[model samples]
Target: MEDEVVAEKTNRQVVEDEVAAEKTKRQALDSALRCLIQGQGGELPPNVAVGMNSLEGQSRKDGNT
Candidate 1:
């Protein structure tokens, strides 16, 4: 049926969107880590640490432990 095909396409699009979002998040996290490493223990604005920690915990698997 046409409705079934539309529903399947919508589901696939949702999955693709999720994959794109996760990839963008990971790239942002990696960039942040590189910046921190280059900073070499310098004091960061408190929000920087908070942001990084939250991003670390944002995964579906809860691997931030």
Candidate 2:
């Protein structure tokens, strides 16, 4: 029973770590895209803007600000 409990905790920690890593990756990608847009004169291209908006909406739905 103790080993099983330890295993479950380890699995949960792995999942949490993966989620944190994913959030970090998402932030990095967002920063890179913003930098690219800024290099293009502070305006996001229409398609990119639409996609970003959709992603933001989904992020909000997922309880992330």
Candidate 3:
């Protein structure tokens, strides 16, 4: 009865939260790809540029493999 209703609501909220998280994750990946494309041309969004620099540094430290 009331417990079933609460359970249904909880299940719906969990689904909504999962959808939101997946959307956010996809958006972040899309943005990173765009930044990488721009970086190939020597331009980058400031935030992504920092991450790219860090990645490049790490690659160099790992012997440029």
Candidate 4:
């Protein structure tokens, strides 16, 4: 019983850490993208669409579309 409780606690902690890390990463990426977009002066970076398209394609292929 004690071992099971410890394992459950550890699993929960790991999930919490992963969620925190993902949130931090997303925030950082958003900040960087915002800076890039704002600094571009009404023109998007050339690779922006390409990158997005690639991600969209991957998502579509993965049935997440």
* Most TM-score-accurate candidate: 2
- Once fitted onto the true fold, the runs of candidate 4 whose alpha carbons sit more than 4 angstroms away are 43-65
| Clash counts for the predictions, in order | 0, 0, 0, 0
lDDT of 2 by residue, 1-65 (tens): 99999999999999988977887688689879998889888888799889887877876787776
Q: Which residue pairs collide, candidate 2?
A: none
lDDT of 4 by residue, 1-65 (tens): 99999999999999988866765675567557757887886655668757755755764564544
Give me the candidate number with maximum lDDT. 2
How far does residue 37 in candidate 4 sit from its true spot (Å)?
0.4
By descending TM-score, how would the candidates be arranged? 2, 4, 3, 1
Which regions in candidate 3 have their CA more than 4 angstroms from the true location? 42-65
C-alpha-based local distance difference test score of model 3: 0.72
What is candidate 3's lDDT per residue for 1-65, written digit by digit as tens? 99999999999999988866765675577578877787789666799769856765764574542
Ten residues in a row with the worst lDDT in model 4?
Answer: 56-65
Task: Locate the minimum summed-lDDT window of 10 residues in model 2.
Answer: 56-65
Distance from true location, Cα of 31 in model 4, Å:
0.2
lDDT of 1 by residue, 1-65 (tens): 99999999999999988877876778687677768766896655678768765665665344422
- After TM-score superposition, the amount by which residue 49's alpha carbon in candidate 2 deviates from its true location, in angstroms, is 3.0
Q: What TM-scores do the predictions have? A: 0.61, 0.69, 0.63, 0.63
